[model samples]
Target chain A: MDDYRELKPEDLVEDPAFRAWVYHGTGAEAWNEWVNEHPDHAQAADLARNILASVRGELDSFPGSEVKNRVQRILESLDAGRSGTHPADRSANHRDRRLWWQAAAAGLVLAAGLGALIYTRLPEAPAEKKSVAFVRAPGTSDQTHLEIVNDSESPRLVNLPDGSSVLLKRASGIRFPRQFAVAKREVELSGEAFFEVKKNPEHPFFVYAGQMVTRVIGTSFTIRSYQSDATAKIRVKTGKVSVWAAETVLTASQEPSTGIQELVLEPNQQAEFSRSDLKFALLENDRPEVAPIPIEQMSFEFRRTAVSDVFEAIRTAYQVDIRYDAGLLRRCSVTASLGDEPLTEKLNMICEVIGATYREKNGKIYIEAGGCE
Target chain B: MRPKLILQEDPVSPLWQLLCSGDKDAFGQITENCYKPLYHYGTKFTDDRELIKDCLQDLFLDIWEKRAHLSGVANPRPYLFQAFRNNLLRRTRRVSRFSEIGAEDELEFSSFSYEAEWIHRETEAGLEQKLQLVMKQLPKRQREALYLRYYENLTYEEIADVMGLRRQAVANYLQYGIQKLRDYWQQVVISLVLLLAS
Candidate 1:
């Protein structure tokens, strides 16, 4: 008990009896008495208790029947092994067979890569020719379309004709018209891409990815729709977007649509469209076990934050390089909520507040300012 | 000075001894008691249920074969965990080498929503989400150390033995992990205050 007199919260968290008391009410009276005696340590003790309880709350366990079944299988195998059958020899054999098959598959993949490399060495063909080929819709064949495919290792920025922009991930492709239609703007996407749609209330933006269509007036969101994946997902970053199944949209095109199962997603909400059942499931960002929301969706809210720190936050969240003199901006501070505006608008607002000017060159933002007043 | 509570000795020690002395029923009892916790812990490593099941079977079978040599083991739970973790990692590495799977040895906690009633009202709204984010971003070794300390309830020395680190290193990992959570909590409180003020 005396040893606990000078213990920090961390030390108390590691104490077994203290943990037992917090977890199961074991020796609660003694711990309560100790806390009463040492008023100064009570806060530390309470903090430690909270930490331990929260951690314990995160634990997950399997069902008792499942445990029993697994144990039964193991004991049965042991019983068989005791009766002159060698489980060790059998498992070793199984491992050898698996290793052999894996080695064969690796060799085949290596051969294919070597063949592709040899073919690429010839100068007649363009490098992007071997990448994804864009397929034009039958009815829209007369309309000129532009396609951008990102086959490189880094994200590629595509500036749409309407001032909207997309940061396309590796192995992704986006196809849009040369000029927007008078009624709306539309794009076709494959794989994953983060989109920042330009605000046009009269002409809503539509994204057709896999078996789903996402309609947004002016917002940023991410859509992941791989050809090989079982489900396509759209996560809203800012504002609201309505998602509908492609079949529903097609049917609505023929007639007035009513009672349509359209899912409206807000910031931090996501909708997953399963290809098998053609159903949409809504999810919140609170579930950490699910695939994380892209960094672009991270919200930014600064309350009297340093101007330099604000730029740093944007730089990291957008994965873009920003050149600025941190020492000059150290004295400049701003209080504003961000994350709903586009990258340029965010920069514009921040620079306006700090009396700074910024220029974009070669995909980087450079800020110039004489020290703040 | 306050009185110290009398802690009970490890209850699994006698069962472990009996298993070592060629008692099959004792081995069964150990398996039944340990399989669920071990399975839950294995989930922190990988999501492949088949792979985890295979490794667990291999672990228990190996233990039965080498019971004579394991009699000197004082703590059975941590000892089993160490062995099982090593086996799972070795198998995953072997599989990933040929398959090109991401075999980074990181622990992933199972996702479960915090019960709102259980959380303190002041910090209840978004604390769980922030905690999850912080937990995800923690270094792999620190997360494992914290898991062993809080989830498995292992002492620093036992955790050190399991992780093959010095006892002080385990202590440092727990301190750093807990401090990160505390810092995030403070930030959340401050942000809430600012939100209310505005």
Candidate 2:
């Protein structure tokens, strides 16, 4: 107690008793009594407490799935060693078990090779083959089905045949028909992509990624479904999107099982589907603080902004490549307040003001004007 | 803000006893309980996630294999930390093979940017970056001591055991670390005031 009278702020910070009292609410009476007796030391004590609490930071943590996966691998490896081996000589048993497992795997591969050979020789069903060919032909065969893979580090823009567009992230790919069917628009996605579907109520758009299917009538949303990830996520930016497990729609003979749940996500809502558990979880708020969706945060309102700047802003927001004569549009400026409209509508308004006509071809937007007199 | 340390009694001692008596479920519980904190602590040494994960696997496997002889140990948290730190350093040394790795190696601390109510008002504006810079400049041993004491909420004795330092030396490191931060903060406050006056 006497020593506390001579201690500085730094000394108080170093004392475990003081820290335990301040941080964990332990030994509160003793510290309060000391502070009341020596009122002058109160300021120093407060300063010391502030200093101790000031450096607030968070350590990066592993996702729960990843942690569980790692723990499971470790536990399984230990179990693999424990069976049919003396506990005292565990190191020797580990090597022997690995060798045994490898031999069993090799035998299975050999058996599968023979089975494949036998099955390929006995296939004879002309009617089934004809139906399969009809289903395989994408959008009446005149329209080629194309798959575009974004191999570069940046997001690659792919224009859909139905005026919709997709910003495919790195190492992602999307497959679509050259012309969408009149009844429905569909695309297969692997990895991650942000889709801006054109509004066409008669033709609903379907995105098949990982184990989940997201159906959107006309809206912008981001879907992240890497093959290696344990969970696939869909975040809605505008409008509503309904998501369901791929089995529910793809499995026609299953009679639509009641266990599979379909989640309808609104703006700023996200749905996460866990592959391991076969479960879907919905996050209602989906605030930007958790993960920022760029398209949602961008502003379309421009006040006397240069035509070229507006194009650049649009290009960045949609991650699409827009080609125009930069020199021609440099002097042209337009003042327009655009809100909630789709990308094409906003472009139409801007082009109308700037006296230029625009067209989309091969996923890129091109503008034509006579030097914008 | 960090979670308050449960200082009343050792939470893992009962689990450790069950593990010693060959309870597989107890081992799983212990691994789940300690995995996150141990993984966070391992990041201070290196940013190689795979390497840290490998060391973690090896540490737990070694503990499981040697559980029969480890029955005498009472406090499992500090003991686990001490073993984990040693295993990580040894693996890091073998991987790098250029510099001699030691306990004095520079420890990395994640920068502070998240907002909290407890952050003092005097050091609120533009102080997060400055605090990060000051923390980076501190000696590696002092930084490690401060992390174990404040963030992890370990007692001085526990920190000493984990860091392989004497109890008094642990106290000295904490005192020096806090003193450095206080001095740096005061300078920041004075400069801010001068800027406002001008």
Q: For all candidates in order, state the fraction of native interface contacts they contain.
A: 0.32, 0.23
- Candidate 1 lDDT, A109-224, residue by residue in tens: 22222223333344564555432222211112223556677767677777687877688876677777788766678787777888888788999988876447788999988888
What stretches of model 1 exceed 4 Å from their correct place?
A1-8, A21-46, A53-57, A82-373, B1-6, B97-100, B105-137, B193-198
In candidate 2, what are the lDDT values of residues A1-373, reduced to their tens digit? 3444565767676666666755434554465557557666654575565455443233442445556776787788788874422223324223211111111112122212222222223345232211111111112222245667665667776768876767777656676777775567877776677888888888988886644777889888888876445688888878899887643111111111244577888988888887544478986557642344366566678898988888888888777779999887788897987644567777888889988899988878899876666
| Best-matching candidate per lDDT | 1
How does chain B of model 2 score on TM-score? 0.77
RMSD of each: 23.6, 21.9
Candidate 2 collision pairs: none
Question: Model 2 chain A, poorest ten-residue lDDT window?
Answer: A129-138
lDDT of model 2, residue A225: 73
For each candidate, how many residue pairs have backbone atoms clashing (under 3 Å)? Answer: 0, 0
Candidate 1 docking classification = incorrect
| DockQ of prediction 2 | 0.10
